[model samples]
Target: MTQARLRVYILSLFLIATGIAVSTFSAFSLAPLTFQVMGVYWLFSLLYYHLRINSRRGSTSVEYGINYNVSLILFTGPFGLYLFEAVYRLIGYLYKKKTKTDEPGEGVQTFYNVGSFVIQGTAAYYVYQWLIPWFEGNLVAFWVLLFLLVTVTAVVSDLFLLGVFSLLGDIRTRADVAAFLKERSILDMAKTAFSNGLLLLFLEQRNWTAIIGLFVLNYLVSQSYLVKAQSAQDKHERNKYEHMAYTDFLTGLHNRAYMELKMKELEKTKEAIGIVVADIDKFKSINDTYNHSVGDRVIQHFAAALKAKAGTDDILARSGGEEFTMFLRGRSFESCLALVEELRQQIESDAVEAEFQDQTSRIPYTASFGLYFFTEQEEVPIEKGYIYADQLLLESKQLGRNRITVSPGQQHESSLSTS
Candidate 1:
């Protein structure tokens, strides 16, 4: 059976067993007046259930303590709690279906939720019954003991059920489970559990002032959790947008826009910067011969080779189609020339496979390089440096591609080198 169907079957059996236990053991001491009061409160609970606060780990939602409150008061025993929860969840499922198709599916999620409530209620009700008699006259001690016992039992039961479901579901790996737990803040659950415990105690005392204060406090807590969730979501979106803005989707390198910004920033530093502009020698021919997909693979392969050769602090970017630019900060002009020559040799040595008509061919590629160096002391603008480098790049192609050409502007110190 599928996980959902298995869960449904198990939950049906558990509910049936709990129902039998409740019917058999309970005194059912409450009058018709209590039942009537519970029915009215169930309506309030339905609204509260809809106004759920999501757990920080984002694994699930809680009804801002209202579910536990109903379990504590309306249901005097486990059987009553189970029956009330069953009805509550059934109506909730129906209401959700009528409103949105985006909600989690009805089977496993509902089964797990209702099953957890049953377990928590069963354990808590029996424990409270066993302990209440021990401190009957000392109301403060009774409330304190009840709060600690019920909260611990209920929260533990809920977490145990959640762990079981996670193990059985998509979050089975240890890393995924850890991340899931981290996302669903255990502390958040503890806070909610503790707050609900206090609320239940206040309600039992029937102190209207304390009850109202507790409700307000719980509402603020829930709101604070939601606000933090929203803030995190906003930060995630901002980071996503920034990455897209600066990254090249095709090669996963920094794009030209980012490189331009870097260039401007580096200009202010007044450090000597070596610029190496490289272009694939026959990229258009490759794309035309092997198709664009294989061409893309070649581009990715080339990018990998470039990244392998670059230093940790080196700035490399895809300036445009089949073209890339590298800036070597604080490197001499000769070092930059040697770096470009190394890249040329690397590209020529590496071979990529391209498949065509059920036949695969190993293709070796080469790129032409144009090198220039500039510093803040130089009166020449960087734009003019790029233009001069492009002129030498054209000369390299004219002299036969797969070679490096350096500009002669700095030839007073050292002559232009070709590789």
Candidate 2:
């Protein structure tokens, strides 16, 4: 085994042994009522297992199981708590195993979870018992003590789990630790404590019906909220992935895939559109002269300038390395030609400042443009318009670069030079 896995196993074994010793020696009362409560809690936990909400980091999930476990620890002590945890966690481990849904090191994780629960529960039980004498006959002090007990339980549980993760090399830096703690909801912890406090109150009054009814009502409300939360989370994830797919990482412009999709959509409408294919002149020389980093800055600089000239209704994309495509909708052919010419002039004037080695260098660059103006009267494909524009762009390059070659309509072409 790897050293990290070995260390995790050793720790798990140590915790398991220590937990067993503590449970065996701990003084806990297990009445018939305790068994009844345990059975009901287990049943509800099993029913609601799939409904749990995972933390933002997905390291842990939130469930009312903790609230029930807290009540068990207080009501029947560490022994009862251990019994409930052991059986519940074992069933959970087996279910994951059977379904082939267990993550790597699932066995170690199960042991760790059981041991951590027992250790935390046993510590909480002793602390509560120790404080009971001081808070006797004082209702407010007792409530405060109970809340403190919950806090103690949470702190011990988090510390134990974090220590294990550290050993497993999951948390190597202060930022990782911060992220771990950040994903844990303080409000969820407060809710767990409050629920446990209510459960304890109900248990003390021997109101079994109230306990069941309150838990059921809380479960229903939580389920509704969880559904909405899960939906929003799914939507946010979808949008995030879509953005990654469609956006160019270098220039932050729409990528070729998005441009093609837009083209298909526009093709259906058969709208009069202007397509422009632009290429940064001598981009290879820019990278060779400075570095790829400077080249990237140049590309970004060019994209920003092009985006500035594009209308809100127009679509612009980085179709290839040092190549861009623009779709200008709702514009006359003359206006489209004028826009491209203006953009070509702007690019010629602008310079990209880049630091190379220890010196600052201002790099002057220019781009060639190929514009195809498509009218509604033409019986041609949008894809063919892009091809024609690309051909015109090559012709512009051949004509000495820094020029806009325009295909007004059909096969008729004209070249405008800025030599």
Candidate 3:
């Protein structure tokens, strides 16, 4: 399934599961309410994902944290946080959609930003203490004060180290987060800071349950983002490898494998295909006389030339050493020859002077082409087309080797067979 479909399905399952868990917890006591805060955060995250899909330019990974903050606030008293978020999005739809997309986050995400959690966590602690029928007033107030100090201090230290580490290039985006925050990497520094601070805060207030729950929640939260980042990194690496496999490293042109794939596609289409086979004329002579280094320069120069000459629909590839091929989309044989000839003349008249290996030299070079055209129903086999083009290349070689040779295929036979 597509990533989008999979994401939607997973989110749907999470929402259902969290809903059931919250309902069960609600039946026994208020313990599930804290997790419900997390659930609400997830719901907002889902909404943000949809919003991002609708606005490509404005999508940001940081939106997830923004949703978490809003969800925490909603649980405090204003019960319609989700509805409020929906209305806010509608009001600023155009504005938010115009924002630029960026990597997950930059620098510590701000002290004020994380400070909101302190406020919410303090409120949650007081509410929990007050809910007990036999709870005394002094105990409840002390617990509230204790939660404020520990949660605030722990989170502050995490953000402080996060800011410092970011300057040292230890920060990570969601797409590449695993490197810095492995099983016990630099990322743990932030977690360790938070844990120590929380220990002090809860110890002061003696709220053991809140301490345990907060620690567990923080672990879950960080790991969720880390896992997501690891998956994205894996995907990016796979795509990079696949691209390297099919691309010419030096010239950045499609390589032989891509050419084979194109041929397969053309076979399926049964459409007319134009092939221009190119060889760097006297390429080995240049390599011997001027050294292989300058010879590489000539190859790159001509590759750039071929790339520029190709039309928008053309596929230009480095088929082999000192050889190239261009498949021009829906073109007649004569025009393909004309283009190849134009490229020849362009290189013949062009002089490329460069300083290489501490020696300045003017390298003059030229190329030859053997053109072939085949409609889908041609009697000639695909491999034979290559042979025919090679023969024409020999003809170009005979005629001083710097021009285009139209194919020797019989037009009537081609028409009869393809028709």
Candidate 4:
């Protein structure tokens, strides 16, 4: 590991050790009422253990048990609080398989989860214990201030621990850290904190009816989170599958199906358009000499060159093996030749290679272009343009390859030397 990673691991170890020590110390010095409060806390913790609002992107989660945890820290010490939280998480680790299934290294993640919660639990304990005794007359104001202070401490502690753990993973910058927090929601934090404070208030008044109401309210929030997360995930999956259906998996370009859709859309427009069909010359020779892998690399290289030459509005697509097509909008027959010649020159000068047994050799290749241009006045079908381009492309291959053959009796021999 590098120095930074070493430091992160060291910090993790330190948090774990500190959490254990504080929990042990607090256990030895627990008040007589601590156990009674802890028993009730455990009941709520167990009930809310599975009620976590998992991130839509599946990065982190927010549990509805925050109010329960905060209340526990205020009544009992951090020792019993951390111990209960750890047990709850351990149960989750064993039975809960949703997030952990996709995530590797569950053992280390368990340590971080317990350690971070313990650290935050201890901080909340200190802040609440130190401040609550200071207020004299107005107990309502005192409770509000104490609740705000403890919640703020919890939020900051949570962010710090999460930021540290994120650094240990793939998150590398302040912007990433901020985005992480923003995506999770600061409003959720405030809402949970307020709920916990209300629970504490009701507990002081021995209002069992209000406590039950809070339970229902918190459960509803958790349900809403689950519904939102699942809906977002479903939408994301739908979009992903749609993209896959229309994309060329080999070269990461548009597939023929998508190109046909674009052609149909362009057919309705009255603007002039040019269709060019280009095929790699002697592609089978490379596949025969080397392997299919090397041929794939050559195709990917040519696709990148093609993308570079095409405009943002131009539609480029892979039309099966060794063949590609482009639809250029608002371009005449002459403009089509200029674009093809520049792209052909780029392909000629492109140095693409594939490695075999630590040896690399350039996969030199060329392509022949056949283009057809149509004007707004012309009622020529798009299918005719494709047929003519393919026919002219075959003619170029027959009569000395690596040349441009345009419709309307226009043929231009490439100035660039053939590969």
What TM-score, computed on C-alpha atoms, does each candidate reach?
0.73, 0.74, 0.51, 0.72
Instruction: Give lDDT tens digits, candidate 2, residues 351-373.
Output: 98888998888999999999898
Say which candidate scores most in TM-score. 2
Q: Which residue pairs of candidate 2 clash?
A: none
Against the true structure, what is every candidate's RMSD?
5.3, 5.2, 17.6, 5.7
lDDT of 3 by residue, 1-419 (tens): 33344334334433443343344343332355544544544444443443321211112222222123321332332222323333344434433345643223321222222332333333443444464344335655544444443444345434533443443444656543444224223343344434544544553465657755664576466567667877897999999998999999878999989887876666666666677788888889888887877877788898999999899888888989989888877777666656776787888889667666698989887777777787677776555665677677677777777776766552311110000
Q: What is the TM-score (0 to 1) of candidate 4?
A: 0.72
Model 2: CA > 4 A from native: 1-26, 53-67, 133-144, 249-251, 260-275, 282-314, 327-365, 371-392, 405-419
Which 10-residue window of candidate 2 scores lowest in summed lDDT? 56-65
Cα deviation in Å at residue 193, candidate 3? 12
TM-score: model 1 vs. ground truth = 0.73
Residues 1-419, candidate 4, lDDT per residue (tens digit)?
Answer: 54367356646754774656574664544554556455666666667665554433234333333456676565555666566666766776776565655354454556666666666666766776677666535767665665565566557555765665465554667886677666545565667667777776776676768877887777777778877988998999999999999999999999999998888888788677778899999999989988888899999998988898889889999987989999887676678779899988777777688985579988788888888776777677776777888888887788677777776565554563444
Question: What is the Cα-based lDDT of residue 330 in candidate 4?
Answer: 68
Which prediction has more favorable lDDT, 1 or 4? 4
Where's the lowest-lDDT run of ten residues in candidate 3?
Answer: 410-419
Candidate 4 segments whose C-alpha is farther than 4 A from its true place: 1-50, 53-67, 79-119, 133-186, 288-293, 353-363, 377-380, 409-419
The candidate, 2 or 3, that scores higher on TM-score is 2
Per-residue lDDT tens digits for candidate 1, residues 52-118, read 7544334434333444543343245555556566677788787778877435555455665666676
Model 4: lDDT of residue 419:
41
Candidate 2 lDDT for residue 330: 97
